[model samples]
Target: MLVEFRPHARLRGKQPADLGASVLPVVAAVSASDTDLGKVRVVCDWVQYRNNFRDVVQLRPILNGDLEIAVDVRRAADAPVGELTSALLRQSPDRVYLEDWRPGRDSCVWRFNALYWSALDLWEKATGRGYEQALPGGESDARNRAAAAELIGELFAVWDRLAASAALPDELYVIELGVGNGGQAKVFLDEFRDLDRHRGTAYYSRLRYLMCDYSAHVLDLARETVAEHTERVSSFVLDATRPRTSLGFLRYKAFLVYISNVYDNLPTDEVAQLGGRTYCVHNRACLPGEEAAELAESVSATVDELPALVHKLLRLGPVLLAEACPDHFADTDAAVRFWQDTWAALRLAERYVPLAGLDTYPLTDTLTGEALRPLLESGADVRMHVSNGAVASFVDTLGLLHPFGKLVCHDIFVDDIQGYRTTFRGPGKYDGSVVNWVNGPLLAHVGRKRGFDVDYAPFRHRAGGHVVTMTAQVRD
Candidate 1:
């Protein structure tokens, strides 16, 4: 573990070794009576040394319970201030697993997952906005409007060609996977409507915009936002990963499947390349205090309980909530407040576990078992996203596109494998849920296997954001 001290900001210099060497300086700096807390970034890098993966454990305790530990073991670990390292050592982690797809918890804290989901539910109920909107200036959809307008213009160009050849579908479909507060959907639909009116193509009348999400609460909020175009709007409660099952009725019939900031929020597995071998890096979510630990345990007691809880909180109506938890309803408002508090207490602990082989690691849906060739097989030593949910969602969503239809997605995409090593992304808390950088190269590979032309570029609608625009179309 390399402990770097930045009393106010990060400093560059060769610091001394562990305890007395590094600890004494921090201790001396904080010896002042007025200073009670300070920050230290402890990065633990685990290199393949022996049969079992050995982590180089180093510590520079900054006033204890105030150290910022970032574990670069398996995947990049995002530890909050004041976290201790406790590895499983010999077994699978008890708390953390690869996240299952849930609309409300597309991303989750391995620790305090239950609290996180409950907090998100409480927040949506209280604010009618998602965690994305909780950030400053994150509530705006102007960039999406520009992106949507450009997309619509291109789709209309394709539509004109299709119509000239008499191949246009009577019902043109535009699907959005994660519709946050319907801000982007409203912009998209409004632009499409305006474009239709200007061109006098009557495309708006034939347009069927499907807002698919896992949370009914979220969908309800989307509906309220896009209420003006109810005539052409439809909503479905479906998993983005396995959209084929619920949206099978419209298979190969839809055009323009659009997604905004959805792929980054999906659940993904972390894989690492080391010593010419690929390994599945595993970590469990760990909370600090006993109270926070208990809250995490209560929420994730079962294997899939956290997702079930989130789904219940999101999909269940108020009357059903009253019926399900009759005892907790006496002080429903206070009960709801507790949910938000639990989410704020989440922290993560990570370690690298040597994989015997890549034989068992699940990569793509169709290409698994011995047939799977892990992307991390590259020569570089790096960790990256095995975005199972995003890939499955991309594959299944592409299946819904017509011959002329195109899939457009905007997200925080890691276009190169090298980006994972240098940049901070994934396995981190946003406001109430987890946010990860989607692996664009992996998605592009999957698209190639499926005979689709997949490409990525910087999000032209915005600058400085990590978001990349990914486009997929049927290859000739």
Candidate 2:
């Protein structure tokens, strides 16, 4: 078996080579070439590696058929080396195999994520609640009327100046991306109309409010919520990562593009710098062998058939999946239950593979891995999300802004390089979608390169909240 050791941010003042030598004996028993375990990876700091989410000693059936043993450096430093062997033996498996390995960007996790939104209505009915109820506070901060009013005030300030020069366009535009249940759009429109009436301005009469989201089901719900302003609102089903494809007509015309709780859900890849070498993290989705057996039996199927069934569920959704595989699923409810169960049982196996060069890494379509060296090599050892989808959307959306226009987003952001070292940034499950904190400093860097000023501040409306407000505008 091939042994790879990755020391994380929590591992301080220790060399990767030293850590590898200390744990060599602990992994020797499972390293036989003929053994069922395909590869071995020893992680020095499991807590920091997994962001303190799971409390476990080892993760089996990881990428490329690897067995991962996680060690607590502090404890291992003091205890007898044999204790590490004991923990490893306790979690060692009888046999290990999985369908395939993939990068985090190519994992089945995203398919499941899209399924959640496409079949959201059915999921809500089966679960007896909406997706928003699964959030921390059972609601999004984006719906705040006060926050809407604040943004509207800023738009008014810009419009007032433009109006003075007789340059205000005949039609005023305000675009909202990721219109979750239309709550934010309703609040903004209501505030705009009220504020416009109060100020005795005709801006409301010239307003064109556009709501965009990836889910048609979500857009339908949003339309109902904001039915009072139907004349001013228009909704589109568009991919958040490539908004320019759908809204190219509005290039350099949109005065405001607002987003909330959206960027964190986009797909991202992580890169790590270890022992003076850079590597890209690749992931494979797996269920523990025993758990796989139990789940398969629960669905009236064998463990060998789980992967194909899962792919079917993701491609056809639970309702059609029930019809497609009547042998495994009695009906839609059964398939929905299977989907939920598999998601809860889902675990990712990750490996660090050496990169040929940083330049070869594509951070996004317009940016490359060369941009990440500054952040990756800033400290001892670190792993950080590249936020590929968010960066692509940010760059494309910038094209939608007028010279004086602004883009505002509120989401989880890692504002400082130190934040990655100290906190769990995510890859956490939020409902059925994925959430990873966007790289704020990197985005600010890219925006500056494109002649725009980007700034990040804590969400002002909610004190001590995790949300950060990022605003970008053409640099004066």
Query: How would you encode candidate 1's per-residue C-alpha lDDT over 1-476 as one tens digit per residue?
Result: 23532221112247322333333333333333243344334443332112111222322222223333333343223221122232321223344233432222223442333334334566566657666664436753334677778888998999999899998878888888878778888888899999999999999999999998776767888899999999999999887778888899988887888787667656776765544555554543333345444654544344344434433544453335445655443344533543454445433344344556666655556645232254565545566777777887998888899888888887778888666665545555556555667888888887888899999988786667566788899999
What is the TM-score of each predicted model, taking all chains together?
0.72, 0.86
Top model by TM-score, which number?
Answer: 2
TM-score of 1: 0.72
| Candidate achieving the largest lDDT | 2
Report how far off residue 274 is in candidate 2 (Å). 0.6
Candidate 2 whole-model C-alpha lDDT, 0 to 1: 0.79
lDDT of 2 by residue, 1-476 (tens): 44444335544555432464346555664553334554455554433332222323445433334455654453455555445455445555422234476567777788878888888988888889898887668888898888999999999999999999999999888889999898889889999999999999889999999999999999999999999999988989998999999999999999999999889888888887766778788877777678788889999988888888888888899989999999999999999999988877777766677788999988888788988988998977677999888999999999999898999999989999877765556687866777788999888988998999999998999777688999999999
> Candidate 2, which segments miss by more than 4 Å at Cα?
1-55, 59-99
Q: What overall lDDT goes with each candidate model?
A: 0.60, 0.79
Q: Any residue pairs clashing in model 2, and if so which?
A: none
